[model samples]
Target: MTTRTRTTTVTWSQANARRLDRQSLGGSGSPALGVTEAVAAMLGAHAQVLSAAELAVGVRAPGVTRAEVRSALWTDRSLVKTFGPRGTVHLLPAAELPMWTGALSAVPGEAARLPGDARMTPEQVEAVVTAVAEALTGAELTVDELSDEVIARTGPWAGDPVMPAFQGMWPRWRQALHLAGHRGVLRYAPNRGRKATYTNPGTVPLPGPQATHALVRRYLHAYGPATPAHFARWLGAPRGWAGQLFEGLAAAGAIEEVTFEGVGAAWVAAGDTAFPRSGPRGVRLLPYFDAFAIASMPRDRLFPGAAGDRALAGGQAGNFPVLLVDGTVAGVWHQRRSGKRIAVTVEPLAALGGGRVRELERRVARLGEVLEGTAELTVGAVTVGGHA
Candidate 1:
């Protein structure tokens, strides 16, 4: 005789409430986690735009200033800025670079799928990766400078055209740059001028299946009660591969299946099913690529009606800043800095209660403090996605 494990069941609201707490967006009432803790909580914030990354951290960790976030990245070396999931820049704790890099590198590259004209020989790819690691160690170099060094070390074959873009040809060697970052060999240097630069984060690469497993656990802990498909989408992994990983984890009892109302069975890290039913506590102004905005899925629940259409474009979230009232995205917002003043405009999908508006104002004030300026809030209809 055998007994079957019972799957936990929850409503979307229940899961989201826990997700809010885990993401550190449960409102100020939720204890303010430190910068490192917050980044680790959400795996890593989406950081394609550095400013968006700064604000994403600021909103979750109360009293955190943008300067302080920069200090953590450059001065203290507590946070590492590098290319991460979906081949986008992200801020991961420096201590955890090995795990992230190892996991990311373990995923197979799509070299075979590239057009014949664009594909680099495996030998060429390896040489470029090695050259990048060598050139960036112990010093920061701009892309142009690094490109020159790679060309010098690996021969002209490394610089062949991968593809032609509106700007120019994307080089073969450049394809490995993000791979180099993911393998823990390189990271972004603080912008000294208009050009982007790279540096070694001073960590050795540790590639393995365990690292991938660790990443799966970390992802599920922060954004789980989800399916392998969800994990694949989030990490940009191949669907079959992600599904196998999820299956193995479940067989090992590292994760358990949960059934969410209106959503089918999904996996969450084991012992992660008890989510509080309470909604979030305060209003929040989330910048572009805020982890909460992008990480949460079946997004219609988070972005009902026109809110989804406004905040997301072409199935990508974070084209515009989001206004979170209670636990859901209530509207969209944008800010323009004019010297010492930041002019902010909020475009709510529906009229907000007077108290909620005031709470949003307080959030705006916090942004002002983060920017070291006076932030003025104006209520109006914003043409979302028009301006940066």
Candidate 2:
């Protein structure tokens, strides 16, 4: 007679996937900035500010300073401010911004909608369009060059001061660029002219019929097991459009779908492994808008109670840099310096201890050198409440 025993293997949750992004991307995944360079590729062209956000979002680490941003130049993930989607400055992967920008503007007249809150008329958009067409008639130019040409031709092209102004134009412009990226019209290239410049994709090939399909596939590889709704939010596309991209990829055998607890697991790559079961816990000093908290479309799964209020606190602004402990969003963090030294103030939902505490401090110390001055740290009370 024989007796039987039962055993089970557990997989990680969507929440765990977020943490995996950190490990996979943080300097381990890509060597040239190589694979990791994909981080910039996925986000499109980014700015230091957005890079900070990228860290918060788990695409990169936070407390990164301007010097560090500049350090990314050349390699694979350098800072190239190409105009796409919203004519905004995105701190994107230097290599892929062109494809991304081209995809965003794929269809003709696609950029006509939204335009801006000012709602520039078609004629107005056309004027700007004409200016762009003329400027890129032969070759690509840097944002400064592009702006110079545009302003020289039309007086002012809107994004004068940069940063904040550019942040606003992402609606229509981003859509246009996203569509354009799908078609391969524009591509990223080394500028040599102080800043990197973007030129016409000039006959490079991109994924076919599955245009958005190819793009979204990368999204999953980088930020997957996500829902259509979440895809829609991150890519800045409509839910229906997101669904189309999702299905297109799945249909093409580009990805695999699994149903998990929250929002129902949705999609991932063909051979990707679900995370291994997470154990007790730990602490992490993540950046604002960090992916750990904001990866999913709904935003509620990981941050159950107050994700909405806290994330939107800056006026529907965006997520702040977050702190994590034991597989959940713990709170937020701020990095300050006293002249030659750096300090990290972490506010947590619970008092972090032992391993988690030491771990966060080490991570912060490493990030600090990659940030301001000499490396240093200072913890603020460890409030068990949350982001105070």
State the C-alpha lDDT per candidate. Answer: 0.82, 0.51
Best by lDDT: 1
Query: Can you write out model 2's per-residue Cα lDDT over 150-253, one digit (the tens) per residue?
Result: 55665453434322243453222222232333334444456575676665544343444444566666666666666787766665566776677677777877
Model 1 segments more than 4 A misplaced: 1-4, 111-114, 384-388
Residue 121 in model 2: shift from native, Å? 5.0
Task: Tell me how far the alpha carbon of residue 164 in candidate 2 is from the true structure, in angstroms, after superposition.
Answer: 12
Model 2: lDDT of residue 351: 68
Cα displacement (angstroms), candidate 2, residue 126, comes to 4.9
